[model samples]
Target: MSILVISPHMDDETLGAGGTILKYTDAGEKVYWLNISNTKEEYGYSEELCRKREKRYYEVIRRLHITDAVDFKLQPAHLEKYDTGEIINKIGNIVDRIKPEIIITTSPGDVHSDHKTVFSWAKAFSKSFRNPWLKKFLLMEIVSETDFALPMGSFIPNYFVDISDFLEDKIEALKIYEGEMGEHPFPRSVKNIKALAVNRGTIAGTKYAEAFMLLRCIEK
Candidate 1:
């Protein structure tokens, strides 16, 4: 079955479900990545920095063995500026082309506006009958974004995937996104990533795991 992962930014897919991605690719399942947001000059990012980040994204795809990927090139953090219908249509077009059996995207509760916007559009398009190829929809949690949204919203994961052997691969893949990693207390830090994986794995009785909030599943 084909799997599509929609990411709001360059590293979200890796931070959210890198290990699970590895498991799928290793199992010979086709996996595609769609990144919706792009860095903007107004965001104070230099062109060099943007180029570096783009390079990191390519590195991530290479690490994951992903052959199909697209960047929607939507302005970062300014997704709210675009009409919702337009955004949904853009995603719907991609859905029609990919025809994935499973779609994973950012969580609605994520603190980042870009992530939330992408999640809303993805959820809407995936549920529409016009796109019947989508059978499963899941919401993945980003470390800093999802965790910081508490008190306003919470991420309560109901689905867990064991990544016992792929946990290290996830961490390594995330590290490819230069300048994203932080120290121990930082949510995006390698230490915290491993910690969260271990915590989720403990709950699921595995050595390592990734957690997701299952949105929909149609059984054949």
Candidate 2:
């Protein structure tokens, strides 16, 4: 089965569903990453940082053993600036081409506008009538964005994946995004990541795990 992970930004994938992604790839399942936005200099990011981040992104793909990846090249944190129909069409094209049975994306409750926009696009293509190939649709929690989101939406997870064996792999992939992680107290810190995993694992009866909200599921 093919799986498509929609990331609003580069590191969101790692921070949100890295371990679960590793598990799928390790099991010989095809996983594709849909990178929704770009890190551009005009977005107040330095050109040097952009180049460095791009290099890291490729390294991440290598580490994750993803089947392939597609980049939307849209402006970061400014997805709202684009025409909604245009952006959705771009993502829809990818969905049609990939025809993935499973789709994972950032929670709609994320505080970041870009993440919220990406969630909308993901939801649009996830309807059962729109994509009969789709069997599962999940919303992953990006530490910083999900935790900091307003109470308009809650992320009470009913799905959990035991990522005990792949926890270290997730950490290693996250290490590549040095600029994204920070010391203790930062939501994306290595410590916090592990803490969340352990907590979820306890709930899942494992040593470490990743939690997700199973938004949609079809037995077929």
Candidate 3:
């Protein structure tokens, strides 16, 4: 089956479901990525820095063995500035073209505004009646964003994918997002990434795993 992962930012797909993605690709499934936001100058990022980040984005995708990727090129962290309908239409257009059987996107409860916005858009565009080609919709959890959400909005994953074999590949892919990682105790740190995997794996009865909230699924 074909799969599509919608990310609010460059590194979120890696942070949230990199291992599962690796597993899918390894199995010869076509996996695509849709990055909805991009670095912008107004965000205190220089043109050179933005270019650097873009370069790494491609490298990360290559390392993950993704079949294809599309960047919406929207300004990062400023998704709220655009009209909701516009965002939905843009995402809908991509979904129409891709016709994926499964879609993985940001959780609605994520603390980041960009993530929240993208989740809403994904939900609207992937509605069962609206997109019959979509059989499953999975919500992934970003390390810092999902973990920091308010108690009432916490990410409670119900679906777990054992990623024991691909855990190291996930970490290696995350390393491509050089600017996002930090020392231990930081959510994006390599240590914490491994810790999260181990924690999820314990819950999943595996050596390592990735957890996702099943938003919707239709059995044929």
Best by lDDT: 2
lDDT of 1 by residue, 1-220 (tens): 8999999988899999899999999999999999988775667789988788778878889999885999877788888898999878887787788788989999888888888888878888566377677788999978999898857578999999999999888888988976778898978998899899999999999999999998898876
| lDDT (CA) per prediction | 0.87, 0.91, 0.90
Error of 2 at 141 (Å): 0.9
lDDT, candidate 2, 1-220, per-residue tens:
9999999999989888999999999999999999989878878789998899789879999999999998777888788888988888888888899899999998888888888888888899779999999999999988988888787777888899999999999999999988788999988898999999999999999999999999899996
Task: List the RMSD of every prediction in angstroms.
Answer: 1.5, 1.2, 1.3
Q: Look at candidate 3 and tell me the lDDT of residue 209.
A: 93
Candidate 3 residue-wise lDDT, 74-183, digit = tens: 88878889998877777778788888999999987888888888888888756778888888889997899999999888899999999999999999998888868999
Error of 1 at 124 (Å): 1.5
What C-alpha lDDT does candidate 2 achieve relative to the native structure? 0.91
RMSD of candidate 1 to true structure, Å: 1.5
**Which 10 successive residues of model 2 have the least lDDT summed?**
147-156
lDDT of 3 at 89: 79
Off by over 4 Å in 3: 41-44
TM-score of 1: 0.94
